[model samples]
Target: MKLIIKSLIMILFAAGAYAADEPDMKAGEDIAMKGTPEGATACFACHGTRTEENKTGSFPRMVNQSQYYILQQLKDYSSGARNNAVMGPIAKALTDKEKADVAAYYAKILFPTPKVKKAASAVLKRGEELAVVGDLKIQVQACNNCHGPGGMGMAPAIPAIAGQHANYLEAQLKAWKDGQRKNSADLMGPIAKRLSDKDISALALYFEQVQINAGKAVAK
Candidate 1:
């Protein structure tokens, strides 16, 4: 009984700490629009200001990403755990609060209906097979198992990959394959290693073309 009481107190304290660390969405929006005082760049120039655009998923749609996933990626870039020629320097320039704020700002934005472009039938079929069900012969797990259905992301951690840039997705997968990106070792690493170049391209293309349900974004 006494032990249980102590555990409850510890849990409450941890929860309180998390709440205090939550970023201010308004402050984040300011940073996204304008450069930070510490020489950080404006995110909009690369990421774009709107939810959806006329172009293909090139720079990526940031609005529906999970705040925690975005923050973790920024921290990874800052610490050189994840290396990007552009993002590495940009992330390094940001203060921790600035990172949190920017992530929060993006998370609060609305998810727009994507203007998806069709991919080849063969590629789409292969992608669907790999995503919805695992390629068991290579020991790969279904992406949806972690990313949720249609790669809409399992919130509070995973970022939505649906309707993301095919090039960007392929690059990241290659990074994991080559040991450049080292964020999700236990999960993403093995899976990435198992993927062939063709598999990678197919998966990226599939996600690039699938639209997410705006508010719910649940697995189908």
Candidate 2:
């Protein structure tokens, strides 16, 4: 009986170690499509597939986002730093390796650029100013300083927000401003606090309509 118990423990440890190895994109793809037997919901239910857009506009586009960014977000959600009723449960359901694998899988997929209706010119202009040239009066820096030109994203961490869903962007900004989301408090928190509701709306709309070459190298 002692020998059997020891052997079982060894097998479990080995399995855990294997799972922590390099990310497996194939496993991630399967999890994204089918969810896990451990009670997590399928990612496709909210995020949609590469060919299909999530018309709800509540969920942000996931394709080609930085793997590191995605992984960190998942970690934040699991830890309750980024409070989301939906994402929290899902992130907790996934193992550390599963999160890494899923992030890697999404980062590799080539998604089509989204097309959204443009907001009023004035709104877009205000948003463009904020994104390209930070307001001196408010002492805010241009969003592009970190997000990269056209929101193409800075390599391993920052995510590409260009052509993302406006509704999702707006909601996230509001969440940060309201102190509901604290995962990126040092950077986004202050910036978002300075943005009025109108500013948030305009910025969201502006980014939704801006398109860029997905394959282009983002500024480091």
Candidate 3:
């Protein structure tokens, strides 16, 4: 009985310490709703809330992202590897724990997809071809090759693009092509460079129409 009690005590103490080290989710929620005093903008202003989809396609949906992926992006923004006029300042302002907390907050929530305008069937067909089967002429692999089937995202590194905002997707592709975004330079850089403006538009619209369930990237 004495040995069992001692073991239980040790286990409880370890669990308490582990929980203490974990990010404070309530603090994260506060940061999201209200920007940090460090000069970061309120994430809700751009990323939206759990109940609301992003107001426009200009912003990428933040929910459903993995914590590691979110953290890396924040780090990249701060380091200028992924330069953005808006995100650069925001990322720089966040302390390390704040970054972790916010990442944790977004990673766990699954937001609903907003209704989006449909693209022309022809355009969607072309986009589907690009996403499902890459164009041999350009030697570009299917977007799904890395993003996972249905753009559900492979997690840890890749982001789910299915049901993402078309405008945001277009913007990112353009950024990659223009060499303005260097985070995934070796991979997305080459692919985006090969895509024409029309192709980019089609791909973006197609992905925006894909059905994604939950934050885990399940296909509907």
- Model 1 C-alpha lDDT per residue in residues 14-107, reported as the tens digit of each score: 4345542868888888888897888778888778775634354456678568777788788888998877787888898888998999988888
What is every candidate's alpha-carbon RMSD to the true fold? 6.3, 11.1, 10.8
Candidate that would win on lDDT:
3
Candidate lDDT (C-alpha), each = 0.76, 0.80, 0.82
- List clashing residue pairs in candidate 2: none
Candidates 1 and 2 compared by lDDT, better number: 2
Model 1 residue 70 lDDT? 84
Candidate 2 local Cα displacement, residue 126, angstroms: 0.8
When 1 and 3 are scored with lDDT, the better candidate is 3
User: How many residue-pair clashes does candidate 2 contain?
Assistant: 0
TM-score of 1: 0.84
Candidate 1, lDDT over the whole model = 0.76
Provide the lowest-lDDT 10-residue window in model 2: 11-20
* Model 2: per-residue Cα lDDT over 121-187, one tens digit each: 9999998899899788876778887788878787555678887888999998998899887776656
| Candidate 2: stretches off by over 4 Å | 1-20, 214-220
Candidate 3 per-residue lDDT, tens place, 1-220, comes to 2443354355345434532258878888999999988799999988899898667778898755677678779988999988889999999999989988998899887787677777889999999999999999987779997788888776666777888888999999999999988887666778899999999999999988887764344422
